[model samples]
Target: MQRGMYESRAYATLLLKNILEVADPMHIMNLKPLVFTEVSDRISDKATKAALHILVNICPWGRNRHKTVEAGAISVMIELLMDEITHSKIDNVGSNLALLSLNLNAPYKIHSIHME
Candidate 1:
């Protein structure tokens, strides 16, 4: 049954995805750390990359979806940090853009990172 499937750890990622789609600011703020930790611990690099790609593409600037993507993308960024090339190549533009879109007043601290 759907309930049983949702209860399983194996379906955690899918559940996260669904939650992300409909989550509000408070929901996203609370869930961010937990989801990041889980993705950091459980997802593979390939999955991380794919997730990042999806997050980046689906969540555009100045949209509600951007917040969801930002939360999820932060996890992908942490996971990507394990690989030198990816860590360096993946810029913080997306993060900055997401923050800007949300109208959150925070200084941009990630722009100094050199992506190559």
Candidate 2:
């Protein structure tokens, strides 16, 4: 998957972006905990970042955002961010931050709650 990102960035982004349109994003939500575990287990810059990018990108849509939050993304991402901070992996830090930001903002996307 990392290699695929390098081979074609557009395709990689598109693949992640389009996952929200699937027949059942909730199914994907169901497996997200396992996926989150795998992401932390992988711990490689490219792999983890790709996974986070995919997860975060899918979160802007209201339903997808709710599903992602239900998947424990906030907690998982916080843990990942802490780990990345300890190692000072600047490359992954940006992605981790983005994931956290998206994860936190996801709840607001569910309703009329305004976000500053």
Candidate 3:
């Protein structure tokens, strides 16, 4: 059987955490638009989660949120959320979208995601 998206996201998150610890994640921040666009692609559950994990990790740093917003985080995240929830039938997307919005201070039409 295929692994679940949660497992994919968890592994992706772990790998990104390692990258952050070892390398300069500043490179990631620099490439914000391309990175966000890749996540918006949603090519696979694993890929999507990996990109989102990177996005989430990088956004906490200085000016990274601004970079993300400049990179079109709001639109990309909204598309990713809509695609995950509506098209691909994925789960746990709302949380990531909310996290991006909170980091970017992005106002969006979709709301009501609670911490659980």
Candidate 4:
């Protein structure tokens, strides 16, 4: 999905979340960039939450976990978490981060979080 397509992006993210829930192969789409972009886009809460849901569904898979870290999901997730912490509005972002941390590249992912 494109950046300008806010409503469409939200719908697409929810759709992907449902699809991922039904199946485990998250690699079905070029999801890395899409999720990273959406998760980092805090302007739209619907899109961000839906993207985080997608991460929650996909991150349990080893390949998708590493793909999330490679896509800079860790840093963006940390930012989202920090935002949540500051606002006292916690949700699944911390869970998503924990899932992403299960990747083989834990050192790199932790370093990225620190860099953020």
Candidate 5:
């Protein structure tokens, strides 16, 4: 999946979201890294948004919030927010970022997220 083109990855992420509706914890853990990677990829906003939506769904589960923080989702979401704000192109990303912020318990780490 990593070697696929951006469009393919975007489609795969959307498909994964559908699968995650009935997925187990093990499935969540296995998919988290790839989803987070796609969130930061920026090669396609479609892919990024799909990945962020997937994270929003899985983050509320047991231990997934901490794992998301460890995966650097906060920083990536913040970066995405900054870009969207600057460009005035905010979309579904705002709610995803908001959900992540509310779910994560790592306030101490927010200051460390790079803005530039």
Candidate 6:
């Protein structure tokens, strides 16, 4: 049987919880590459944004490590966020506010973002 797309918010929550509980730099380093492909497949812009935001927050960043997230995954997520912000209509104030917060608070530095 083919594996289904990740549908469990609970699973995501638990995974985040577990990762935070351990909080190991080496573990984060190991996991980054493994998660890249799966994360890239999540095409929905909102979902992608949410997932990447969570990943960035959970992974520890500093002068030495600079977050455990893989470069490939970060690149893909940045592209998706930029596309969504540029192409989507800001009809809902709440969503716009949330997106704005994410844009401001997200761990990665995004330069020249366009919101549509």
Give all TM-scores, in the order shown. 0.35, 0.45, 0.50, 0.62, 0.66, 0.42
Look at candidate 2 and tell me the lDDT of residue 4. Answer: 46
Score candidate 2 by lDDT.
Answer: 0.50
Candidate no. 2 TM-score: 0.45
Candidate 1 off by > 4 Å: 1-10, 44-116
lDDT of 1 at 50: 37
RMSD of each: 9.0, 7.9, 8.1, 6.7, 6.7, 7.5
Cα displacement (angstroms), candidate 6, residue 47, comes to 3.7
Give the alpha carbon lDDT tens digit for every residue of 1-116 in model 3: 02346556455544654675456645654654554443444445555555555566566665666666676755765676777676655556756566666755643221233211
Candidate with top lDDT is 5
Error of 4 at 43 (Å): 5.7
Give per-residue CA lDDT, model 1, range 1-116, as digits (tens): 12334235435554555556566644544443334434433354444443443343234323424454444555455445545545464456555345433333232221122222
Give candidate 6 regions above 4 Å deviation: 9-14, 17-22, 43-46, 54-71, 87-116
Q: Can you rank all candidates by lDDT, best first?
A: 5, 4, 3, 2, 6, 1
Relative to the true structure, how large is the alpha-carbon lDDT of every model?
0.42, 0.50, 0.55, 0.56, 0.62, 0.46
Residue 20 accuracy (lDDT) in model 6: 47
The ten-residue window of minimal lDDT in model 4 covers 107-116
Cα lDDT tens digits for candidate 6, 1-116? 01644456435544553564456655544554445445444644454554554454444333212332343555565555555555654343345345545544554542222333
Using TM-score as the measure, the top candidate is 5
In model 6, the clashing pairs are none
Please state the error at residue 2 of candidate 6 in Å. 8.2
